[model samples]
Target: MSERKPRKDAARNRAAVLAAADELFARRTSPEDEVTMADIAAAAGVGKGTLFRAFGDRTGLIHALYEARVEPIRNAVEEGPPPLGPATPPLQRLPALLDAILCFKLDNRHLALALEGTGSDSPYQAGHYDRWHALLQAVLEQIPGLTDSDFTAHVLLAATRADLVEHLVGQRRLPPEGLRAQLASFTTKVLGSPALPGSPAEQIHS
Candidate 1:
């Protein structure tokens, strides 16, 4: 027998269930909270069996939620900015990358908070940090009069991370613009000079 397509109502129900689960998981408190399949099914107005059939289990559902939320940020960083080229000055590209990074964090604050609450070990976290560190290091390496220990680039990247920004703005009440300027200053200092004079990529550090 040919497989039957799901009825329109069934499709709607599935969508509703996923949406509900997303909301709950996004706001779930404590890893110990019992966010059972039943809770998600009820929230979505679907049957428990439907929920199970749609998503293998709670972990699968959580993973789906995270992927749905975070994919855009990853894409923006990897592709949205100007292409990384030898001719392009890191200083100019750096600001664009920073702007994109900040926008991602601000847009996904709630999801970020949820992820932090889970305390899960994610390769994405390490990979993302490594990528940022690498990019900054590459920029520094291209500049003159600014060679240092390998750890310096990592330290600068870590200092200017999204989590630190969230803490500074959300918890410490620093204006976002002010924080951005301060971070730019710190980054420039860490990198030594923006660019060499007469170089198209050169930028003033101050």
Candidate 2:
């Protein structure tokens, strides 16, 4: 009974922390750099020690929150319907997956940025990134005559990186729809889809 009580309390505290962190990221207007573990701890109504113990550090907390928020997309790609699910054709699913990722970053801009900011070389170091990359590589392998699925997956995922998203949407203020269109076009080109009029790929082929 004593052991169970501590476990229950730990789980409850963890949930509170995640909920608080999610709310803060959702409503924050200030720079993501300004948000801190202390802020999350205060918002969660837990002591700083509990926050650190629960998450290890700010990066870990951000990762946990990111994983929580991205869970739905993961589920959709894993078992849900066409476009995102496993049943979709690789060619079709590739773009759909990338589009979903781009939209996720756009919707959770600050949180995404914060996660990326924690990395030095690239956000690819994030643990969740490995799962995405592995899934993309497997999908790429299903494409006929496609080579270097590993490298190709890396390149494709880079297009949806959080920092790039922030630059396009946050700095340049590109409309969400416009960004989605651009990514679709880019993916089409990468997958060797027939080039549309005025596309640079079309010009090169011409």
Candidate 3:
């Protein structure tokens, strides 16, 4: 028999779908710039069945996009340097991480709103949220005179919830720079850290 043809191109199809979806959302000024699954499927040059098979549903697709955008921040937290890397002091890292988070939400505001509005449960119950919570809680556990890291992590993450970020940036018109400063200050207060010379908490907005 002649050589068998290679099976269908799953990886290529997935990349195409993600790329198309990213472009569609990147151009979105509002959540109303909604691109349906059929639209993405058409744009990616794939069938609706393939898009569903690859991503399960619209929410799943949205989550995938969120995860993709946030993956770099996650890697930095897991393996990069001071304030984000594992080696950074917990108090410093906490605020720094929050800054990263706030920026991420601001940068991806429209996408975050789309994802946040989905499902009955809090979006924090999903993928990267658990990792962020666990990492933050673990770091908080290392600090002295601090209690309830578990609860603390949940609360901190809530401070960056999509709707709130949207309100601040989209409605209240908070500048990204100003928001970063406010968050850094809030984190410093919550962590009970007096700003020391060049400390992560002190320097986060810098």
Candidate 4:
């Protein structure tokens, strides 16, 4: 019972830490680089020691927060229904998948920036990137006449990169819906088809 109590406390602490970090990143006006583990600990009302023990470092904390935020999208893509699920047609699903990713980056602008900016490791080498690439490549493979699924996947995913999203939204001041329309058109060209009908991007505003 004592051991179970510590485990429960640990889970609770982890949840509190993630929640605090999410709030901090969402609210920050400065670069995410300035948000430290110490800041998260203070905001969570936990000691710095506890925060460090739970997440190891700032990068890990950011990664965890990103994963938590993306969990719903992940589930929808993996198992939920059409336009995102495994059961959808590749032609339609491809645009939906990319649209979902773009929307995620747009919504969590700061958090996405933090994850891509963290550490020295190449963003392309990250586990999340690999999973997205693999899934995209697999979908592309299903479409007829689409060769080089690997390179195509990279290209499509590149369009949704956090920095690019920031540039278009922040620097260019392009509205989110406008960006989505552009992406849909770009994706349509890549797929060698007319603009995809019933795109999941519509659900964003609905």
lDDT of 4 by residue, 101-139 (tens): 999999998888888877465678566888999999999
- What C-alpha lDDT values do all the predictions have? 0.58, 0.84, 0.81, 0.87
Clash pairs of candidate 3? Answer: none
Give the better candidate number (3 or 4) by lDDT: 4
Quick one: ranking by TM-score, best first? 4, 2, 3, 1
* Residue pairs in clash, model 2: none
Query: Which 10-residue window of candidate 3 scores lowest in summed lDDT?
Result: 1-10
Q: What's the TM-score of every candidate structure?
A: 0.57, 0.88, 0.87, 0.94
Model 3 deviation from native, Cα RMSD in Å: 2.9
State in Å the error of residue 18, model 1.
Answer: 5.9
Error of 1 at 3 (Å): 4.4
The TM-score of predicted model 4 comes to 0.94
Preferred candidate (TM-score higher): 1 or 4: 4
lDDT winner: 4
lDDT agreement of model 2 with the native: 0.84
Q: lDDT by residue for model 2 over 82-132, one digit each (tens)?
A: 668899878778888888888899899999888887776568777778898
**Which candidate achieves the best TM-score against the true structure?**
4
Those runs of model 4 whose alpha carbons end farther than 4 Å from true positions after fitting are 30-33, 119-121, 203-206
- List the pairs of residues colliding in candidate 4: none
